[model samples]
Target: MKPFRRRSLLAAGFSAILSVQHVLAIQLDLQSTDSIKAAAKTLAGDMVSYYTGYRPGDVPGNLPSPYYWWEAGAMFGALVDYWYFTGDDTYNAITTQALLHQVGPDKDFMPPNQTKTEGNDDQAFWAMAALSAAENKFPDPPEDQPQWLALAQAVFNTQAARWDTTSCGGGLKWQIFAFNTGYNYKNTISNGCFFNMASRLAVYTGNQTYADWAVRMWDWCSAIGLRDAQYNFFDGSDDNLNCSQLDHIQWTYNAGTFLVGAANMYNFTGGSQEWADRLNGIIGNLKLFLKNNVVYEQACEPVGTCNVDQRSFKAYLARWMAATAVKAPFTYSLLKPILEASATAAAAVCTGGVNGTSCGLKWTEGTFDGSIGVGEQMSALEVIQSNLIDIVSGPVSQDSGGTSKGDPNAGTSSDIGPSDLNVGEVTTADKAGAAILTVLLIFFVAGGAWWMVT
Candidate 1:
């Protein structure tokens, strides 16, 4: 069937799933995974519609003019989770193609075209997508293509090399190149991503080096006050000021990144109390983003000033927190109600847009706030599908059935393409088509052993 026809049918069929009283909203029966999957299918379909990158005359790894290259990476990551949780392969082919096409010459996601604007965080998001692919056991790429584990490790290796020690003691600068805006700042998202990636890599590959890097990043963040006494992770600090002052803005993704990273560390150390305290601290502080149990962009939602990028912050937090529940196990009870409430609110706000099911940025409103974008749709999709967290098995590692190959020295090469090109400019649009693991953990659940370790 044609795309429009499928959307129309899906929109028309929403009535059967929605509650009669809340007919204007997409109401989900959170207790039922089938109901959750149905809602997720609708949200994911709507979310992927915003992408034009896969079409003729478009860049394969990009969304459009307004959406940045990094978000496209993040969206694909969410879709990977969508497939993992719901068993929907609807978006897999396109997702695979998009991921492979953007691997760049070095396969570190530093595609030559994106070097102008790519930051540590931007590249890390794409690496996170590859990380998600490895963890979720998404179908591996063809033997000739870049494997998922290698791609993630390449990114880790390159970024690990970029961890600057000259300023603020140690941390990654916001941007990769000195000319890019925000280059003088060192942000939590950038370093938190590294920490998250490293912790998971350690769990997956059983590498002490990656775990050491994870601990170092966490300590640097804390020592520099990016993570405050209350464990509230602020935004970036100015390296020009010698890291004396922070941006003080608390974005959900910042906390979410560190949250999962801490969870993995907690799991990696065999449930150490130190990591547990850090996990609980971050989780407690995250309540600042919650309003009556639903997740909201507290930094910008109330002011009606959320920019395009800020709008998608909730998606990462929702997904990361859900991942934390699985990785840590102990946090499941604490995280569940918040996620469930947010998912319901997210669905309720899907009453907007042409199809009357497009999500909005503010879930606190309890109604569609007339906002719509890839971010809104993605936030809704992730939160809805994450309801499957408990039912579905958690991520896998090489010790388990994971099949993605790794390269410890992957991104250490000095042969990456030049860094002067336009952010999303694809030189040869003709060759667009292509194709595209963590850890062992042992948890004691109710006096019984929960074997997350393969």
Candidate 2:
């Protein structure tokens, strides 16, 4: 069948499977169309309240209490993804506003006084969202707004300088500066983010340098054993720079971030066999994260102990699976079962809105676990939006509705809020309060067994 004919038929036939496709999606792409549609409906309804905590007008520095730049960045990245996947412009402002608030004068992302909290990894997280904005042309900012593409490039430039070739055959460090203990740490996330960003930038710029960086980052990651033969990514080896002594810990995002990078490199290389092998190997390794075909934070949460960060990790894995699935038809069919189950179950976990419409963590249980917070809401949003990508782009003959030619990311775009508003100018008292709040995050990062381990 021709592409449009297939898409049109799929569009009309889309209604055929909503209530019944979950079981059949494992066998066919047409069946999963309904699953994605069904999942998108629930996400559209809850997105407003789910994002209420992160808006700029309401909170100090325009962030909710227990502010985390990295998590907020990921949340915004997911929202931009939703906009691109569905062309729903309602989310455009929120994603733009929140991100603009963080882009300082340097084009580097640090939300003002919270500099102590963000490392190279944290900044990369925010930059990841910016890159998504650049790739998809989510929305053009209004006149007198930050140029999303330039901001993303500024981030890449900063990261490129920090790519330490001296360390274990070359990779990025966990911290951008030396003040913190993580400065020398060559972790999966820092380099994974670099790999992902570089891969994406290569596609956006048609720049061979970006492509080279992507290849180099992945090679180093594998050489260091951070990405092992099985393609599973371990947590960072602490500050040694030797790239030996793989920490051997696992997290959904560590492995997940690398997959998208690999996929992009595959696409950029015009489907090179080397990148293809890496993509397939990475996907095969991700099987360890599944339970009965549903994705989970496998190493944690089964014992009722997913900490602040781990609770949200699987969302990224779901996201990249759908993002790259458009390029890998085989991987799409293989991965859609988990996406379908995750979207349905994740939607069913909501129970805390004005009348029980919000979502919570522990989505696999299909019901709220008596907890409600920003991280859980962010996680659910990521996967729910993820399903939309699969619906429009996965395993079907359609132009990638989510992206286009020549990186249509020129000119400055406006924001939803005041452009000049800084993130936080903390007073002594606010610093004290933020200090207490930062403890939970610090403990969370230090692995109260939280192996999303940055």
Candidate 3:
């Protein structure tokens, strides 16, 4: 063979091998969309059962009370999304029931005091997100739905009112009671949730203030929170340095929340090319982090370089990555591999006995051997399933509808009385309180267990 021809053949052979490897790594049976749907359905069902059965109240016994609320809200939101995509009324009914149980007339809305739980701001984000999903699904405005809107608005106001311009360079305070105490610091997760909720509220109310807050929060994150040089996804504090020293100590939820927030902003703003470019950059970095086969080990920082070994970060990353793929513009071919890999990895973690239907994956590390926490499982499944829905339904046209605005009356609801504003102390000694405490403890242990295992 001629030297030039030989070289071309060699290059072609190498490219073929690479393509085969990529296909094998993904391990998706393209012919088995039914299997994928079934797996997602089972996972969603298990998650709803776990949250409703194990963690029923907002009290700190096992997991911190605030954590439970956050997870519950997130799970409900995901379930609502799932219903939206799959047209599964079961998921919808379960999610509505769960939200009513948590935020309905008789439930404790905030976490107990002395638990060191961050304020219910995270729940506010979840509540607002879920409400948005509910509204999107059922166009007819509920007569009593005004109360739900009022509750979310009250939470948003409380969060906005607690914003601190000092120390952290102007971001929402993490914990309301610990304002400026310096013990509880400003972190990306809180701000991400704040931005996400604010953006949603802005759309719902048709108000620009909430939209402005969302943009400002994004600016704060991009400017101060992100450690671009070292590949750190978010800062633990607003005043932190830009160096990537924190890269080794990455948190899955932090990255996921930030990406979702960014995606939400992009969706609301009618597809800014800059936002799309930034998301692509982040997506590239994230995929590079996943070069290693193990999800948990891929992003281990200071202790190990990125993409090293098995770690629990995959659950959170998978959920967020799926969220990004679903909401943002991306080629189906690019997303198909990721969706398959994420779903497969999630399935491997199922502790609920993977007989195709009843088994569920553990969202965090310490979940009961057979349990899948509501938030983790629901978010993960929602991300994958929602993307699948979009893929099947066809790409969303940029001009389909302009970004929805936040509710105008979101901040000034007189119906949110004084009682709704108070975040009482944690007292779990009573029977009802003990039950809440037990559930919280279980979630906490599961989260701690996942953290340790990862």
Better of 1 and 2 by TM-score: 1
The alpha-carbon RMSD values of the candidates against the true structure, listed in the order shown, are: 11.0, 13.0, 12.6
Global lDDT for candidate 2? 0.66
Q: What is the lDDT of residue 400 in candidate 3?
A: 37
- Every model's TM-score: 0.87, 0.76, 0.65
> Candidate 1, which segments miss by more than 4 Å at Cα?
1-24, 415-454
Task: Compare the candidates by TM-score and give the number of the best one.
Answer: 1
Tens-digit lDDT track of model 2 for 116-176: 6667678888888877776666665654666666676667777776667665767777865
Sort every candidate by lDDT, greatest first. 1, 2, 3
CA RMSD (A), model 1: 11.0
Error of 2 at 42 (Å): 4.7
Q: Write the per-residue lDDT of candidate 1 for residues 35-100, one digit (tens) a residue.
A: 999899888888988997665445566888688989999999999999999888998987887888
lDDT accuracy of residue 380 in candidate 2: 70
